[model samples]
Target: MSEGSVRFDSDALQQRILALRGERVMVDSDLAELYGVEARVLNQAVKRNAERFPVDFSFVLTKEEKQEVITKCDHLQRLKFSPHLPRVFTEHGAIMVASVLNSPRAVEMSVFVVRAFVRLRQVLVEHPDLAERLDELEARVARHDNTLSTLVATIRQMATAPTAPSRQIGFVVDPLEKKE
Candidate 1:
């Protein structure tokens, strides 16, 4: 994943991230990896330009939040090895940060991340009606509160009538389970 340079649009990335959650708060190390710089360097830049980053713009993770994030994101477990807690930055903070760092790569990559956030936000917004409807249906199902035959029939109707897509999502026990 770190062989050569690839072209990326920071604007698009920012947009995608915004769509995801109006914020592009990624761990410092992940940003460093994307920008092809050391995480220490990014921190240094932020420290040097402290005025540009406010509480909303950027801040170090709280100890409790850091632990929670680490647990949720398996890929970040290695962060435990570091002495310092990770930092998170909102979109505005990230954009300001790229300038402070003043590296072409950082600037370009920041735009890509920004666009990505925006795209995510857009997807969620676009589905508001569908999301609301699904929530209502779920609430109704919960109110019924029983795995009745009528409920099963309704669920089955929602499921494939056997002619729809054969493949469906489901959970399975460990495939290698030993037979009792």
Candidate 2:
């Protein structure tokens, strides 16, 4: 297929990619929509090319996880209502689907899927260091709070401390000016 035969919409594809089980994945239904095919057809292709997809490439969601996904993502309400659990395709798996389907639209849209995955990976890698830094800062701050509280108490005590008696400067000093 020619590059300009059809334009791929990366933005739309990006929205379909989701984070689950510490990896980004797209459900079969979303991929089918992107490739202009039905979900069953896509699943059939995956089944036919089973060797191409390993566990890392794709996995079926567990019942508990499926419930959590349904609870968290309103867009996946179809998954909630559907009797069968949905399978998710990771970045590599999504690209492999293109080769399996062997359609021009699938080939073109696969490029978009790959790009979306790349963008998602870049964002994940770039932003997580800050979260780690934030966690470290919070721990350090918690430790410092104990030290700070003690230091503040000591300062308050010093502020209210008693003054020592001073020696007379000279023999001519006024006795009346001094407290006995």
RMSD of 1: 16.9
lDDT of 1 by residue, 57-164 (tens): 887877777776777677678877777888888777778878888888877776766666677668669887876796799798877876576789898897956665
TM-score of 1: 0.60
Off by over 4 Å in 1: 1-4, 7-24, 129-180
lDDT of 2: 0.84
Model 2 agreement with the true structure over 1-180: per-residue lDDT tens digits: 454654445666677777788788988888888888899999998998899999999999989878977887777898877988899999899889988999989888888788788887787688998757867997999899999999999999999999898877867766679676
Please give the range of 10 consecutive residues that has the lowest summed lDDT in model 2: 1-10
Question: Which residue ranges in model 2 land beyond 4 Å of their true spot?
Answer: 1-9, 130-180
